[model samples]
Target: MQALIDQIEASLASRLYFLSIFTSLSLPDIAGALSSDNGEASSKKFIAWYEDWVRPRFRENVVSQSPPHIGQYIKELANPFDGESCYRFRCSLLHQGSTQHPKSKFDRIIFIEPGATTNVIHYGQINGALCIDLPGFCSEVLQGARAWLAAHEVHENVQRNLSRFAQRHSGGLAPYIVGVPVIG
Candidate 1:
């Protein structure tokens, strides 16, 4: 559970980092791309910016790879795929450049939306493509992990177990993971 907690914390930081990459705008870095007078930004340069904008589209990838121990501890996400399992989606995306599975239940996984909220993955037909909201999917994982941690926390026996586990992993005198002050 401690290790799982560590993984969740790491994932939170990682997703935030991924979020930064997702929202990054390369045009702002160039001298005159966003200038008031320069309306003729190179189309190729804009394409390059588009290339840089796509971040790691693996929030579902993480959910698919959830370990059994972690699985029991965390929230159970409603399976979203009709034609594909979570594992297959992860494999296809990781091995291939995009979600190019011909028989994929989802036509495309939505990585970036201008305004998306509510931590829920909604399936719908967009231009004949099955769309999955990336942030919403990741938000489900984050919420689940936090719920599990909170469930076992602020209790004497559980805290003791966590402390002992942390100590065992650290080999004594030091803490297991750096951020866990309760066990540190």
Candidate 2:
């Protein structure tokens, strides 16, 4: 079991590595303009270029076909505490940003699990509607959200570190996203 877990972790690491690489390469070319001496002018030019050249391509290639909607699913399971019914739902999203940055410093995968409720103890809420069991469930959900946000922060740090390394190695000519993870 330990070996299996280790293998799964290794596989996930490898996938993340490749995904980072692919994402780096797929990032728009506007990053190059950010390093120019006349950054303001270059930034404008890059934004124009990206709007004209890259945005349409990205919309075509990357955006999903699914309609924007919220959903939930429950799984029936035997409760460990007392042979009772249990349910779990996994949530995720392919999020994007809508800022004015030359290169869209945005794109991420977010994962979440719906708060669980039991017969005796109710979970606080499901999708904003109120429920009145398991008072601690809300706290657990908050913790999960904090953990996800922290993971994002750590990922951003890694990208920033890699950007610095690349800049140093390339004598300041390197683009931020080239060969670096896109964490935003």
Candidate 3:
């Protein structure tokens, strides 16, 4: 869990440094913009780049496609959905500097409040759109990523930590002994 958290934190830092404000990409997530030969004209924007790359990567990266929708499986990558709607949201953000999706589905998927102090706040309304703190949305995505990491790799991480502990310190907690064996 700690490992996953740390990884997520690092990923966030990378996200900020590489993107967050100005996009490094000239063109994003569209056809015929990639060379596959070198790193020239590479993208550093998360939303746009993620929109372009996530689907194919989801198909090729994961072992199984049980739920089929990557968002259903990995909510951290794109919240509220891992489908076209979220992609549209990304498009809106990239092109419009806001997560306002013109379509009702996209609007319902994620409600973004442009200016807010707190990280997150759920605004209730009788006949208007629900307002959500944008910062909170980012935090929620991080939380989802952490959850994803834990769900997928907790056991493997534990095993790796145990092995490392055993190797690092002689007669440590690793290779734990349960009880004495009786002679047969």
Off by over 4 Å in 2: 1-13, 17-42, 62-184
How do the residues 80-124 of candidate 2 rate in per-residue lDDT, one tens digit apiece? Answer: 211010100101111223112222112222122224322433323
Worst-scoring 10-residue span by lDDT in model 2: 82-91
Residues 18-100 of candidate 3 have per-residue lDDT tens digits of 24221312223221122222222233333444444433343332325445674356543323334354455556666877646
TM-score of each: 0.35, 0.20, 0.32
Please list the C-alpha lDDT of all candidates, in the order they appear: 0.41, 0.28, 0.39
Clashes of each: 1, 2, 1
Best lDDT among the predictions, by candidate number: 1
Stretches > 4 Å off in candidate 3:
1-85, 96-98, 106-120, 123-130, 153-184
Residue pairs with colliding backbones in model 3 are 119-136
Report the Cα lDDT for candidate 3.
0.39
lDDT of 1 at 16: 61
The residue pairs that clash in candidate 2, if any, are 122-133, 122-134
Q: Which predicted model would earn the best TM-score? A: 1
Per-residue error (Å), model 3, residue 172: 37
User: Could you tell me which residue pairs clash in candidate 1?
Assistant: 107-130
RMSD of each: 18.7, 18.7, 15.7
lDDT of 1 by residue, 40-95 (tens): 34434343422232211233345557787764554544344421233334445545
lDDT of 1 at 171: 36
